[model samples]
Target: MLITKIYKPAEVEKAADELRKGELIAFPTETVYGLGADATNELAVKRVYLAKGRPSDNPLIVTVSSIEMMEKFATDISDDARKLIKHFWPGSLTFVFKIKPGTLSKTVTGGLKTAAFRMPENEVTRKLIELAQVPIVGPSANSSGKPSPTTAAHVYHDLEGRIAGIVDDGPTQVGVESTIIDMSTNKLVILRPGAVTREEIEEVLQKKLDTDHHEVGKDETPKAPGMKYKHYAPDAQVLIVEEGKWEAALNWAKKQPYLVGIMAPGIEEKTLSKNFVFFDLGNNVEQASHNLFAGLRYFDDKKDVKWILAAGFAEQGLGIAYMNRLKKSAGDQFFID
Candidate 1:
C-alpha cells in the first residue's frame, strides 16, 4: 500500500513533484477535489482510471493552468468558445474541443477525436499545474459512482491507499463540478450541468445550448464525465423530497424500520424523532447545493442509515446544477406519499 500524504497548502510544490514523477495526487479546485495525473503520461492517466475504478471510455477532463496548455492538445476553437473562455476560464466551466491527432493519448481522450479541458480558479492548483509543466487529467477524486470529494479529507477517505497524496486547500467553494460545454461541433451542447448554469452560458454567448445529458450507450464514448455512468450516489438509498412534500416525507421517514436520514432546509432538529438523523441543507438553494454532497457523505458514514430523504429544488440557475446531481443520486425517485 502506498503512503498517502496530505500536502499542506504551502506544500503544493511537493504535490507537483509527485505529478512529475507520474504519481496520482488529489488537488483542490473551485468545483471539487480532482484526482490529477500528468495528462501526457499514458501510464499515469491509466492509473487514474484504476485508482478511481472509473470506466475507460468515460473521458477525463484535461485541467490546464492556462489557455496555452489547453491549446497544446485542443484545436478548432470556435468564436463562441473563445468568448466563453474569456469570460469563464479560470473559473467553473469546461469546454470540449477537437484535439490535434496524437497530442493526447487515447487514455486521456477515451480514444475520441475530442477532449474536455478546464482552467480551474484555484491558485494553488494552477501553480501545481504550472510547476509540473503539464496539464493533468483531472476527474473527481473518489471511488466510482460515489459523491465527488468536496474536501481534501473526503479524497483521503475514498482514495487513501490508492493514491500518492492530496493537496489540502480546505473545502471547495462551488461544491460541485464545472459546467461542461461541447464546442467541438456547430451545435453547442451542455453535456453536464454544474456550478456554471445554462442561463449564464447563454448570456455569455448570446445563444441557447442544447442539453445533451442523455446516457451514453454501452459501446459509445461519452463526450464528458458524468454522462455515461451512475454518479454521485451514496451507499444509502437517496429519495428526493420535492417542494411541499417535506411533511409527508418526514412522516413517512418516522415509520421506516431502519434509521432514516433527513437532508433539508429549516427543519427543527428537536422536533424530529431519534429514528431520523437530520442534516441541515442550509437556508437557500445555494447553500443547499453547497451542502448536498457533504450531507450525502455524512449519511453514508453512518452504517445504520438505510434511507436518505434529501430535499429537491427548482431546476433553474444554479439549482439546475444542484438538482442535476441530486436527481442522479436519488435515481430520480421523489417522495410520493
Candidate 2:
C-alpha cells in the first residue's frame, strides 16, 4: 500500500500542512476518498494527475470548506446556481461553474473555461480545507478509470507510493461520487448522478432539470468526470442480468463449468447452488449503492471469478447512480435473453 502515514481527523492540520507544501494527500469525503492537492498550486495539482495517472484533459473537482471559499475560485454564479448551491452546499452536489481568472491552475481545469466546484458534507474534508486555506481539487483516490475508492484502504491499494499521505476516516458515508450538475449551461444539466438524486434537486428548484448523459471518448473533453470513461470495473468482466431472466442467467452460468461471481439483491446465500462466489448487495437500492463497488472489489480478488452476474436494479433514487456505474463497468453487456 502507498500510505506513508494514515492520519486521523484530529490530524487534518498535518495533512493540510502537506497540502501547502504542494503535496498530494488522500483524504475522506462524504462521497469517496479523494486524492487532494492545493488547487491553486500548479505543481501540486500536476502531482495529482500524475499520481492518479489521470488524463490531463479530464478536469478535477475543486472542493471547498464553505461557500465563501468557493467564490474565491469560481465566477459568474447565476441566481439559479446560487439557489441550488445554497440548498445543497455541504452535501454531495457538485456544480460546474465558470472559473475566476487565474484563481486555479490550468491543470485543474484542463485548460477549460469552466471548472467543477463542490462542498462535501464530511467534517474531516471541511476541516482539512479550513486548515489548508485554499480550494482543494480532489478526484477519487484510485487510479484513473478504476472504481472510485470509498475507503482509505482502497486508496492505498491503487495509489501506494504515489501519494504523500492518506487520512483514514473510515469508509465514506456516500459510497459513490457526488452528483455533478452543469450550471454552465443556460439550463442546468445532470452530468453525473450519485447519492443525491435529480428528483431531490428538482424538488428544491421547482423546475425540471435536463439529463445529459452520453458517454464521451478518451479523445474528447468530457464536461465532468465519469461522463466518458470505463469506470468502476473490476478485473473480472461484469454483466447485468435483465429482470425475470436471472433464473436463466443462473442456469447458463451453471453450464460454464467455471466459478461465477454474482452481485444481486435478495440473494439466498445459504441456499444458492453451484460453484459460485455470492455477494449479497441487499434488496434496498441504497444498500446496493453502498455495497456495489466494495462487492466488485471483493469479487476482483477471487481467483476463480471470471465473470460477475449482477441483477438489474430500477434506475430510481440511488439506483440511478448504481445502474450508471453498472452499465459502464459491464461494457454494455446486458443479458437480453
Candidate 3:
C-alpha cells in the first residue's frame, strides 16, 4: 500500500472522494494527524483499526463538519454540554455522549453506549469532512501505543506502506490530543486532558468539572482509549523532572553515563557529562502543547539516546493538561529528584 501525498484542494478532494468510498484517509488536525474512515461505515471504520493496529476495545474519535452533524451522533445533549460546545467547538475538545441508534458503529464507539466526537478547527480536516459528505472516525495516525504523528512526514514515516493516502498539511499547531469530557452523567467528568483545560470548560459551563483518576490503573475497562494504557511513548526510557527542579535535573542528567535527551520550555544548562539533544518549546503553554509529541518523536528516532529527561510544567491552565500527558507517558518509572 503506497502512501499517496495530497496537498492542493484538488488533491484533497480526490482523497476525500476515496474516503467517501470507504477507503481510509490520513488527514491533519490542529492536535495531531488522524487516520480517518467513514464513521457510519462499519467496514470503513474497521480499516482504521487494521491500519493502525489499534485494539478493537479502543474506540476512535468521530469528526464532523458542524455541531448539527455532531448532534446526529449523540442520543441526548445536555444544556451544559451544549454551552461548552458553543464556546469550544471546532477546537481541541471532545465530548462523549450516548450514541444515537443507527447513527454510528459499535466499532467506532468501542462497543459502548456512548461515542466520542469532535469538530476539528483545522481547515483541511473540516474541508475533508465536508467534501466526503460523511462523518469520519479519526484516531491519531500512528501504531497504537506509539507517539502520535503531528506532521505529514511523521505519518509517512510510520505508515507509508500501511495506509493509502495522507494529507501533508505541515506540522500540527496544537501538538497534543483533544481534551475528552464525558457528558453522560450530570457532572462533567474529564476522561482525558489535552490542549483544552478543565478551568476553561468549567468557565463556559459555570460548573465545576470532575476529574477521574480511577482510570489511571484499573485493569477492568477504560473509559476512553488513552485511559486504559500508556500512550504517546517513545522508544527510549522517559523520566520526568519534578517541578522547580529543572536546573538541578538537567545537571544530573548531564552527569549520567548514557546519552541523554532533554525537552524543556526555555531553561538552558551546560552539556558536559554526556551527549545531549535539547529542544526548547517556548515558554507559553500553547507552544509547549504544540511541540510535545514532535519532540518525543525526535528523541525516539535518535539511536544514541538511552533515556529521556523531561521537565515538568506548572499545573495551571493548559499546563496541567500538558503535565497529565507527560506523567502518563513516563508511567510509574518517573520520580521527583
Candidate 4:
C-alpha cells in the first residue's frame, strides 16, 4: 500500500513533484475533487482508471492551465467555443473537442477522436498544472459509481493508500461536476448538466444550445463522463422526494422497518422520530446542490440508514445539475405514496 500524504495549500510544489513523478493525486476544483495524472503519460493515466475502478472506455477530462495547453491536444476550436471559453474557461464549464490526431492516447480519449478539456477556476490546481508542465487527466476522485468527493478528507476516505497524495484546499464550492458541452461537432451538444447551466451557456452564446445528447447505447463510448454509467450512488438506497411530497414521504419513512435518512431543507428535527436521521440540504436549491454529495456521504457512515429520502428540485439552472445527480443516486426511485 502507498502512503497517501495530504498537502496543505502552501505545499502545491510537492504535489506537483508527485505528478511529475507520474503519481496519482487528488486535487480540488470549483466543483468536486478530481484525480490528477500526467495526461501525456499513458501508464499514469491507466493507473487512474485502475485506482478509481473506472471503466476504461469512459473518457477522462483533461485539465489544462492555459488555452495553449488545451491547444496542444484539442483541435478545431469553433468561434462559439472560443466565446464560451473567453467567458467561462476558468469557471465550471468543460468542452469536448476533436483532438489533434494522435496528440492524446486512446487511454485518455477512450478510443475516440475527441476529448473533454477544462481550465478549472482553482488557482492552486492551475499552478500545480503549470508547474508540472503538462495537462492532467482529472476524473472525479472517488470510487466508481460513488458520489464525487467534495473535500480532501472525502478523497482520502475513498482513495487512501491507493493514491500518492491530495492537495487539500478545503471543501469544493460547486459540490458537483462541471457542465460538459460537446463542441467537437457543429451541433454543440450538452453531454452533462452541472453548475454551469444550459441557460447560462446560451446566454453567453446568444444562441440556444442542444441538451439531448446524454443517452448512449450499451456498446457505444460516451462523449463525456457520467453519460454511460450509473454514478453518484451511495451504499444506502436513495429515494427522491419531490416538491409538496415531504409530508407523505416522511410519514412513509416513519413506517419503514429500517432507519431512514431525511435530506431536505425545512423539516424540524423535533418533529421526526428516532428512526429518521436528518441531514440539512439548506434553504434553497443552490444550497442543496452544494450539500447534496456531502449529505449522501454523511449517511453512508451511518450503517443503519438503509434508505435516504432526498429532496428533489425542478430541472432548471443548478436544479438541473442537482436533480441529475440525485436521480442517479436514487436510481430514479421517488417517494410514491
Q: What is the lDDT of residue 283 in candidate 1?
A: 88
Q: Please, what are the lDDT tens digits per residue for candidate 2 over residues 1-337?
A: 3446789888989999999998889989878889899998898898888888888888899999999998887888998888888888889999999877877777888778899989989898899999999888889998887778888888888888888899999998778889999988688899999878999999998999978866576588887888866788888889899779899988888777778998888768876667788998888778778888888888877978888899878888888898998888899799766
**Which of the two candidates, 1 or 4, achieves a greater lDDT against the reference?**
4
Report lDDT (Cα) of residue 184, candidate 4.
86
The parts of candidate 4 lying over 4 Å away from their true place are: none
- TM-scores, each model vs. reference: 0.99, 0.96, 0.93, 0.99
Q: List the residue pairs that clash in candidate 3.
A: 175-290
What is each predicted model's overall lDDT from 0 to 1?
A: 0.92, 0.86, 0.82, 0.94
lDDT of 1 at 113: 94
**Candidate 2 least-lDDT 10 residues:** 1-10
Alpha-carbon deviation at 190 in model 2, angstroms: 0.8
Which segments of candidate 2 are over 4 A away from where they belong?
Answer: 1-3
The deviation in Å at residue 50 for candidate 4 is: 0.6
Q: Give candidates' CA RMSD values in order.
A: 0.8, 1.5, 2.0, 0.8
Q: Give the TM-score comparing model 3 with the true structure, all chains together.
A: 0.93
Ordered by lDDT, highest first, the candidates read: 4, 1, 2, 3
Residue pairs with backbone atoms closer than 3 Å in model 2 (clashes):
2-160, 2-161
Give lDDT for model 4: 0.94
